[model samples]
Every structure is written in C-alpha cells, then in structure tokens.
Target: MPTGTISKRSVDAANPESKDWLLWDDDLPGFGLKVTPAGGKVYVFQYRLARPGQAERTPARRYTIGKHGKLTPDQARKRAKDLAALVAQGIDPRQQEIDAIAAEDEAARVAAEQARLEGELAFENVAATWLDHYENEKGRRPSSVRQAKLVVNNHLKPRLQGKPMPHISRSDLQPVIDAIPAKQRGMRRSVFAYASILFGWAHKRGDIPDNPLASMVKPQAPKARDRVLDDAELVFVWQASAKLTDPFGPFFRLLILTGQRRSEVAAINWAELDRSTATWTIPADRAKNDVAHIVPLSKPVIAELDQLALAEQIKAEEEKPDGKRWPKSGFALTTTGRTPISGITKAKNALDAAISEAREKQPLPAWRIHDLRRTLATGFQRMGVRFEVTEAVLNHVSGAKSGVAGIYQRHDWHDEKRAALESWAAHIEAIVSKKQKDSKVVPIRAAL
Candidate 1:
C-alpha cells in the first residue's frame, strides 16, 4: 500500500506488479487506486458502516467507481468524496446502488405493463379485432362487412378512438348516436346495431370487462321503405342522370334497366356480359342471395352498355403510353380499371341535386338508391307480370320461391323475366322520350 495524493500523473505512472496493490489518497482515507497483476487499474472506495457513538463496525465493502481510462483521476476523486459523505451519514453506498438499480427495473416493468394495457384495451384496437372476427369467423356477407366497416370508420372510430375499452360508458356513446341527421333514421339504427355488435364481441372475448352499449337503448329499426319514384319523378331522375358524368350516369341507368342491387350493378365485369345472347350473368359469389342470376339485357340496356364500353375504350386510348395497348377487360363501371366505382354516396348526392334542379318544384321525397329496385318491382306488378316472374327478375328467393317451394321449384322463369324487363325498359323509354300519353296504365300483353 502507498499513501499519497491521487493525481493524474501518479495514476498514469502506476504499474501492475506480481500481486495487486493499493495506492491510497492522502486527503480521502478510504479512497484509493487498485492495480492488479493483470495490468488492470481501477478507482475504488472501501468503507465500513458505523453509527455515531457505536463501537461495532460492519465488514469492509469495496465500491468500484470506474476503470483508469474511463474515469479521470479528478473525476474518480470527486465520486469517492460522495461515497465518503454517505458513510459519515451512516448510509451504505453499495446498498443504495442496489436499491437504485432495483427501482429502475421496477419502473421499467410498470411502464411496460401500462403500454400493454393501452394497446390491448383501446377502442380502435378492440374494434379492429372484433371486425376481423365478424368478417372471417362469422362468415358475414361482403355487403354486411362493408356496412359495418363504414359505420365504424365514419361514425364510431372518430368519436371513440383511443378510449380505453374498460372505461367506455353509455354516456360516451350517446352523443355519437345523436349526431346523425334526424332524417337518416335508418342510418342511425345501423350505427347503433354495428356498435352493439362490436362491443358485444369484445365483451365475449374478455377484451372488455363489460359492454358499454349494454345499457344504452338501441335505436328502433326504421320502418320498411315503401318509396317508389312516381312516373314524373322517374323520368326526371332518368333525364338528370344522363346530364351527370360518366359511369354514374350509365351506372344509374343500368340500375333502372336491370332492377339489380347497386353493388351488383357496379361490380359488373365485362366478361359477365354476352353480346350474342344479350344476357348478364351475376355469379353466385357476387349475388346478395348467393344464387347465380341471369338478367336479360333489353335493347336500351345493351345500347347503354355499348356506349359505356366505347367511352372506356376512348379513355384507355387517351391514357395509354404510345405503342402500348390498353387491356380490354375489367369492371364495367369503374374510373380505375382495377376496382369498381366507389363514392356512390357522393354520386347520389350529385344525382339528388340534379334531380332537384331538373324538377324545379317540390323536391323529390327522400329515396335511397335501393328504392329503384322496389320501383321496378312495382312497375312489373302494375304491368300484370306474374309474382314469381317479378321475383325472378329481382333475383329474390322469397315469397313464391322460399322454403320448401324454393327447394323443389327448378323453373328459373327465364322467358318471363326477360319479357318483364324488356317491357319495363320500353316503359321507361316512352317516359323519357315523351311519347307515352298516360303513365298510369300500359297494355298487360306487353309484359307477358
């Protein structure tokens, strides 16, 4: 052992010997530099715990401050003075270091647990998981899945995002239900239904302690829509749709001509149509009822399709790079060739505006795009078409063709459906062209 001032020159000059040796600082009693036979030099502080006026002393414990190159001689001396102060105050510096490390580890564990709870219990995350289960596990229809997603993204997520699932209550959700327009009662009911389903699923999966929507009063189902566009309103819509932009104009016209659902009409592939047979085949996978349907293309429908095809070809020609040919097949009603037309709500709003402008009178009563199918069914019935044939045209498996009757009745009513659609198209043409005198009654034979 060497007793001297621990200076930078002295620490640098120290060398390892056959055995470890200590060089004690003159000013600090227990602080020193220890050099090992392996040529390792480290700053150290050795201390024994003792209280004032006590005779008993604890065994000596050495604290390694740092290596020689890592900590300068002056830096090691300052740290040793801190340890000496703790010893005079009857505190054990080594135990304090152990407590600090343990506290840091405990703090890290708590923070990680809080983060896990946040990620697992957030409303957005729970809803995403519920939707995946709803679509895949429950095997819901694509349209149903789409409607649920729309309600979540447009109505629910904006209001409840990031909220803890366990903390959500009915009070947090009532305002979301109240925000929808009063006139949109059906939409309000749909929002409530989707939210209920999501929370219910989360509760069942133990992701939530309880369903927040359980006590909330669900909105009553809206009354069935009986809205049918009158002849003048129908003609107004037809003429107005023509004045609007591409795809939408033709898309709306196809809905009227075919009496098909908006989604089915919008997703029409070019390959689904046969020019020679003048028929459009909606495959089972795409049909809402999961039944393959063959719709006869009336002259007007075929003509409208031809115009759409020509417009698409023109667009392709304009957009294609020089010497590159555009692919001829994709969705029939699409802006991008890869996907079907979307934003129908915006397009419908535009159509409503056009219809309002065209009418210039009492604004047409609130009607959904789905009302077009009802109107077509009503038209077929008024024209004396058989009930079964009308159902076949709309591809409905209810009424005449449901249950045991559906299982046994193999007749597709192909001819009757074709005639009914052709007559309806002619009726629409007559209304649009201003050639028909009375819209109330048309010859029954025309439908048969």
Candidate 2:
C-alpha cells in the first residue's frame, strides 16, 4: 500500500528495525531494497500467493528474489514483475524459485563435466581428480584406486604431474624415476612410461604442453621375483605356526600355499572361494595387477581350509577376544565380531620374538613370513613344475606379450596343481616334524 519513491540515502539512514515501510518508484510491484548486518545494501522481491479461505488481514507470503549486490534494486523490480506474471498464472514464486535453482545446479554439473573433458588437465592432476572422484566419491574398490594413486604419487606426480606437456624432457624424467626403490624399478619405469601416454592424450585435447618421458632412457632392472626361502628359518616358523590357534594356523599356512601379499590374503572373503570347484578366485579389485586370478587349490591347502569349514568358525569369532578394540571387518586373522586383525604388526613382532627365543636352539637365517611363499615357489620349481604354472601360482604375467591372452585366457588346473602344492606342504611338514623331534639344535654362535 506504500507509494512513491525512496532514495538510497534515506534508506541507509533509516533504522534497520523500523516498522514503517517506504515505497520505491518503479514500474514493478513487490520489489524492495534492504541492508544486511554488514551494512551492505541489496534488493529483493517479495510477494504472496492466494489459497482457499485466504483472509485480507493475512500476512503476504514473502520470499526473496535475489541479493541487492547480485540484483540491483532496478533489476529486482523486473524480477518482481516476472514473479507477478507467474502468480497471475496460478504459480507460487517460492516453488518456481526452487525449480530454477535445481535447473541451474543441473546445468552447472554438466558444465563441470564438459570443462573436465576440455581442460586437458595433466595426467597426474586428471588422474588424481578421477581417483578422488571415482574411487573416493563413487566408492570404486580401494585396492584398484590405491594402486593407481601409488603409481602417480610415488613415480609420476613427483616428476610429471605438474610439468607442461611440452616441457617433459627425458632429462627431467630420467633422474626423477631412477630414484624409486630397486625392487619396484620396473613398476617405476612403467608409471612414467604411462605418463607419456597420458600427456599425449591431454595434448590431443589441447590440455597439456607436451609429453616429456618420450625418448628417455628407460629404467633398467630385473622385473622378476626369484627369492628362495632358507632351511634353518623354515623349521623355526613351522614350530611357531603350530603353537598359534586354528585360523591363524590355517592363515599362516595359507601364505605358504599362496604367495600373495599380506594385504591380499588378510582381506580374503567368502565370495573369493569355491571349494566345490577346488579353486580360489581373486577379483581384479583385490589383485595387485588389477586383473582377476584363478588359484588352483592343492589337497593340503584345501585340507587346511576344510579343517576350519573354509575359514568360517574363525570369521565368526573376530572381535570378542576379552572385549579388545578391533579393526573393521573382512580379514583372514580376525578373532570375533567382524574385525580386521590389528596384529599384522603384532603377528610379525611375535614371529621375530619367537625366532629370538629359539636362537639358541637354531641360529636361523634372518627370515620373514614372505619367505615361506618363496620357499613354496622354489620347491615347486625344483619339483619340475612349469614356469608358467609357478608364475601363475604367484598370479604374475611377466613374460606375456599379448595383452588379451595374458589377461583373459587364464585356466586353473586345480587337480594337477594340487599335487605340486601337496608335495611342497608334505615336504615342509616332514622338515617341521623332524626338527620338532631333533633336540641337538643349539645356537651356532656360542653365548658369551
């Protein structure tokens, strides 16, 4: 009901809590200007919609059109006109405002995706974003994402993620990569090598300056694992394995049957096994190479798992041991209540401690749990197992040239492979039993 024009100067001077209203000289209705707590003045449009039994004395349902800074008082007047037009058509301004925001959000999302496609962000940056987006946000498997992150974080990002595509000279790359640990040198080389491919991909889209790893000296390192387990240390660990409980006993034994990483075995789930098929399937998400593998279980390995009903009883009792704090679920070494074993370190510490205690009984070679896997691999090779079977047992595809065959044409000869595993397990059992009975054992080095 207010009329005429209110000046900016008058508006600024008026008390914020003033009950009296002022009019703005504009062609549109329901438009107003106000100041925020910061004293920054802005414009807004407020209006009402009619409903059944609406009274004249009822407060006009009000909603904000825009901030004064974003929409000047004049612009707010125009928006008020639009709101009036919508109201005239039986639409509520508040509902229309919400719909507009939703549409804008959808547009913004599409724009962000298009920008990502066009930006040619560095392979390192783009990959990092993708990993963060797909792996962290969308819940892609952790192992796959971690492997990709490791490649970038350890090798690619340090040298190339920030480099302009064109400035990636081999001179800059060679020294950066030659620094990764020798054990992972081949993997290190492949990462930078992959950076070149990503850079080229970015360059084609005008995203990067150039790919730098091109024409660089490739890293030199043997990409094969050939470590063998020692004899004296073997007897000590075998003794300790029996002293542990069922699942840990079976788990510690599983490592000997399978040469996979500690993380891989610890994360073992029921879905990965099929005793009916006599095989274990490691999904690409859980595998180190990001490729699925089929392990042909031998009788002794099968027998070991069968003893625990395929690792069921131990899985059920994960986190209830004396009400101790436990890790999250899904592991080979849990005690009760679906906990991952916190004792990865504790288990290894106990291993070293046991070895220390038995040092007088046997001055064994310094060995790790991984040594058991190596010994099994070495034993199979000595037993005339094919190198392919041995490498496949370790789930490696080192010599494969064809990508399709290397990844796809995998077959698990469970029955045949079981013979080799049984032979190895029996031999270790014989060695273990012999050491248990033999009491002549003493520290080769005499105590001072």
* Whole-model lDDT per candidate: 0.86, 0.61
Instruction: Give the 10-residue window scoring lowest on summed lDDT in candidate 2.
Output: 439-448
TM-score of each model, paired residue for residue: 0.68, 0.51
User: What would the per-residue lDDT of candidate 1 be over residues 108-142, giving only the tens digit for each residue?
Assistant: 99898678668877889888888888788543567
Q: Identify the runs in model 1 with alpha carbons over 4 angstroms from their true place.
A: 1-113, 131-146, 179-183, 209-216, 315-328, 360-362, 438-448
Indicate the worst ten consecutive residues by lDDT in candidate 1: 319-328
- Evaluated at residue 86, the lDDT of candidate 1 is 95
What lDDT does candidate 2 reach at residue 183? Answer: 78
